[model samples]
Target: MSLPQPVPPSWKDLGKSSNDLLSKDFPFQGFALEVKTKTPSGVAFKVAGNRDAKSDTINGDIEAKWSDRKHGVTITNTWTTSNILRSQVELENQIAQGLKLDVTSSLHPDKSTKTALINAIYKQSGFHTRGALDIFKGPTFTADTVIGRDGFLVGAEAAYNVTEGNVTRYAAAVGYNAPEYAITLHGLNNLKTFTASYYHRVSSDVEAGAKAVYDSKSTHGGVGIEVGAKAYLDQAAFVKAKINNAGVVALGYTQTLRPGVKASFGLALDTTKLNEVAPVGPSHKIGLNLVFDS
Candidate 1:
């Protein structure tokens, strides 16, 4: 007999398809670029820079990582322009067959700010669990678990304030998965907010999704809806667009220039404000991203 496989996705990733389409590749207020390469010693390096037009400021960060596939260990460090250094170490399948552990720390040069966090995840056929603890700050503890079988999943998550001796947050989610589409429903913030998301792959090159959210704690208590679609123009290019109930529309186009280079363009406009007074420069926002990987 063949061994059964584990559940396809974890609780947090239940609605990732529609979420990524609606959230990713949206325009920003700045220009960003990133370059990644690997050295002969098997160390990976990434450098990223951003320039904000409104603030007229430039900032960047550099990250380096070393991984050992045989031992299942990885170490990474990042240095940012704000003089903060972050380091992380990850170990997989060291203690158990389906277990992973992560340790992360942050340090500031000029300030006394220091923080550390530890996380662990374990997965098996039909079950997944994760736990995280903050060591330096409130010393908070959080945990979540999901049980899945035959395309049905249910999960719950909660965070506790160790110092305060109280539960800070709790949420639950249920989902169903299929070959071509997935659907999920989540009750977050102690059941004060609810969200429903759906994703479908129409064809090999076309995809569509939608999400709806309702918040009982909001001042207006309204339901918000967003629909989006993505289509691959060809092997090297694709386009995405999404519109929300507030009349905000976002469009994105990405193209692979070469084997190691990619470029993306994004535009966003507020249709409700288009009839108002014209802005000084332009009434819409545009963003550009260029990436190179080797």
Candidate 2:
């Protein structure tokens, strides 16, 4: 028999019941399973399909790793309906002087695309900085940089649209963090849009957050705000909700059924369109997850 995993009381701290976790859409609606096992040198990973009720298809990935204290290497393969779809390999190492470096390559058989990425990060004097480079089959290149410290973090990223053969978009963000809360300001596409968010833990079991967003190109062309809250009903269950100035509302509940088993339900509504000529109906979703250690 599997031992019962003791559930913790700090739901808000874990973001388990947090509505602010999602930026643009409702929570996922599917079932997933994962199993991990310890090897002599590293670990093995298996992730089963994130099965959706609407679709009867199943997919999964398997991975193996070899590692020690300083470095590791991993390889993975993914399959769907008996068809091998993708493969990926990665290598990472912590070099002398506290520098960490990693390289990854991936191939998608169905898409006829391949990608390679290299990155490095280093830390000193309580400061951290990192950079990355990506190359895809279209000969496209992208670069990113990030720097951060305890209470402050910032980053900038730009991507080359390989398919479009153009450098199209860029983004940046700055944030301040504390033990009880965090706030962030961000911009995308050279300030074509902006967003600001703040989150605070009201207590050990409850948390609240709000976000304000602006898009110069939107129909409204005005700032919109969203407020969210999460509360732990007990160690085994929790609920979360969010409301936005656009008259959109979302609510979710999660419950831990047993060790390695969990479930969730979600509902979303658009109050502004409830009684319109072409009424938009409410939406509901459900999900289940199972995890195991072999």
Candidate 3:
């Protein structure tokens, strides 16, 4: 008996380089699948006025790429009772070879289904500086503050690492989103964001990360910070956690299920100040995720 031969992990290597000198741009192709669900309790129950649980969603993203640092395309389909049905196709490319400039944009076809929740989620994520009490529990309510359906986003990123490989590196990016077309609703427009982060390899099995983020809108802007750690158990498994100043934290676990495929799941807990006086207690959330990249 030859025994079952284990397929070598590509994501572990795709995250790094082959020759080591670094070839940021190489032609590559891949495929991925995932089914995710989130349920809320405590604060979520209070804010959304839901006596039971939030809705469940199953989404899949199919993607193809030339390489880690090259151009590619992705198609995503999301299904939810609230969203009904939504799909997106995006194309991206890099320019200014030395400066790391890249342009990205996407198009929506069966769009209006999510007309109300898209903007709501952004606001919940701190769409502006003035924090709002935006919650995206499900399609049960027609939120007074948000518009549903058809939206588009275009953005770019640029980064040049003076020094590479774990010791230290800096990167910056900016992007924007807007409503594409709507017959009976309006979506927030001119949303902008920027991010900068540093990576430190504390040791062979561990690393630390720090980042600053800002987002701007017509009325206000938001600023936040995040910190995290990553640990590798071996060549096939790893785990990480990230926390923000607002008391939001996420823990993720991942492993290579096959040579060209990997899977992951993340659990998250978050609390927002609600832009009010008394602090709102943390809202608990549980989520599951899976990914496959060929």
Candidate 4:
């Protein structure tokens, strides 16, 4: 008997390239800094801050996590501009052979919201199916399911507002995967909006992808689009670049400084904003990231 082949991991490589492009465009006002440390017992601690030098604005958060083979817990506390505290906690466990459960709670000093999620997966004769439910959040619920065989997948999801007694949103997706390339199409808000993506591995060291989104309700002149590529220079270094329909371009490079340390830098520019008449060379930004492990 021949064994079934598993899906290729190249899709993640494609996503990494896109994420490098999107990081600098975060809705937040400024650049971000993050640090993480893991202990021998699988406990981890993290801290992150976002700062804008021009505005002199900063936001920070701290998190801690502990995990074993089958169960995990995490807690995060955030400090907003008004110095108000918000905390979130999550717990996850594998309850049975193919079933998993997760619980999360978001809390302010005065009030709290809680949610529970259940996920299950099954596979047989080359077919796989997974289903999940996100329950009890402000009287809201989301249910989703996915099924796949070989290299093709389809998924549907819907959300309901219990208090309002209405279905708020619905979405669906279809995807196909092969050794060298993959594509997916997604529809949201009862098909009023759509997004599609394609990824391809050009060679052993190069991967490229593009994404586009459209919304029928919007009066925009053109679809939102982005294209990106990532290349591995060697075992220790890689570079990425992306350009969007809005005339903004970004470039990033990451390198392993040593066995347990890594560093990265990114720069972005909006070419359309640069002109003699505008008196601005370009709306440009730069960011750096460093990671350490013990």
Candidate 5:
């Protein structure tokens, strides 16, 4: 008889569901748009722009990508209005099965600054691991790994500064994932902060999540809590709402306007300032986003 194969979880995706529920679709002081298309020669291009309401700054970037599936190689380049150029190249399943390699670099035209990094990832039935090294700057080294069996997962990550000859950061996480729900606990910021998160798929169209954070080094030294939920009204529209311990409430609505177009609206309000005769600044914030893809 053959035993059931184990599944390895991604270290970076430990609390992704809970994090997305509590953070995604929240309002910001900006308006952004993105358009994506592909060329006949198999090159993909994306143009993105953002307008900051507070700073009155308009920033944008243009990105292009080319992939060769036969050779298992992909290359991408992005140029930003801030005079920064970034590039990344990836190779998958070339050296060995379940192995991937990536090289990324960034250059600043005005400052004449350049930085590069190389990363490697390997994954198998029950194990996953990743490592990265900075070729410039402090020449830091970072690594993380996760192992899972029977829906239980454990992972750890650390980073070391080569120039300083010290371990700059370290963290650990444990999680359990089931068909209906997932729970995770994480020790972050070198163990100075801890967080617990839970996510549940209540029904076909309803999902809920919550997160609690405790900072040992904070002045308040108390646990902060946040809860959020998302519900799909129909095939073309959805709504999200969340509240935090500080009496801040946020709501978001998204709808598909057309076959290739979508729009999202967000609003945030401070309940604590409702009694104040006149709030010092804006007591509410709003955000809008639109996207087009072809």
Candidate 6:
């Protein structure tokens, strides 16, 4: 017989993250199986409990995947009663696709709204883990972008980072668009969150951005403000650096190959200093990444 795997150390401290990161661009080799409710019914079995005992059932789950920058992005939107489709469209419409005016109207006018639904289940449901410091890491960046006329600019950069990717294992994605301000969301754990970020290009050869994720569950979601910068290298490779948890910092180098492939190596200390933020741990994680064109 097997018992449930206990969540790792310091679980209650981490917040819910999305499974998207696991599928988009990660560099790791492993297999996973997710069990979801199907008909809400299970094989009948005898019970030792009293007649008042309620019947238990098992539901089936859809399989998830793990992708990296080396491959391409895999769009895995399931249709569980059509609501899934609606939600996906809603999210896509909201993403800030730096498109021109002619293209913007053709697509959905983008506006990141702060709604109750967005507040509750934007990307909340997924496998749960308990750990000292779970991480939902990824390298999600698009190669060639489809362009429109005016308002429709670039599709929301389908990439994931410490808090931007899918936030699957360790966090809620600190996501946003330039225009969108005052971001907010509520977790199933009854915890609330807020995030904001901005990007600017210096000399067209170098670009930089900064973002933060705050978890009401603790004194703060991340150790503190998460900041990073990216610089392009001959259109193939780029370098980046960041600091978080009000202390720990990191630096990384990434490269793109052909058009559909990407890879990178990162080094850091205390990477994600959850609350109480400890000293920076080891300072390096060599990652082989890949992402496919969806």
TM-score for each model: 0.94, 0.72, 0.37, 0.78, 0.95, 0.34
Expressed as tens digits, the lDDT of each residue in 172-205 for candidate 2 is: 7777667788777778776789878888889989
> How big is the RMSD of model 1?
2.0
Winner of 4 and 6 under lDDT: 4
Model 3, residue 43: distance off in Å is: 48
Predicted candidate 3 versus true structure: per-residue lDDT over 3-79, tens digit per residue: 33222211112112111111111111111244232233211110111112133233333222232323543444444
Candidate 2, poorest ten consecutive residues by summed lDDT: 7-16
Give the per-residue lDDT of model 6 (tens digit) for 1-294.
544333121122221121111112222121212222222232111111111111222222232222222322222223221122211112221333311111000111243321111111111112222111112113322211122222122111122243464533222322222222212121222225454444555545665555555567775345345555656677787777666555655666667766654565544445444443222223222333333322
* Worst-scoring 10-residue span by lDDT in model 5: 275-284
Q: Backbone clash tally for model 1?
A: 0
lDDT of each: 0.89, 0.62, 0.36, 0.64, 0.90, 0.32
Better of 4 and 6 by TM-score: 4
Best by lDDT: 5
Better of 2 and 4 by TM-score: 4
Pairs that collide in candidate 5 are: none
The RMSD of every model to the true structure, in order and in angstroms, is 2.0, 8.3, 20.1, 4.6, 2.0, 20.7
lDDT (Cα, tens digit) per residue for candidate 4, span 1-294: 656745222222223333434453332234566678878777677777777644667777766666555454455455544445555454444444433444444444444544455444443343444445556554666666555557776767777777888888888877777778777788888999988888888999998888898999998756999988888999999888888999987888888889867777777677876552321233766666666654
lDDT of 5 by residue, 206-285 (tens): 99999999999999878999999999999999999999999988899989999889888887778887754322347666
Deviating ranges (above 4 Å) for candidate 5: 1-6, 275-281
Evaluation by TM-score, superior candidate among 2 and 3: 2
Q: In candidate 6, how many Å is residue 37 off? A: 32
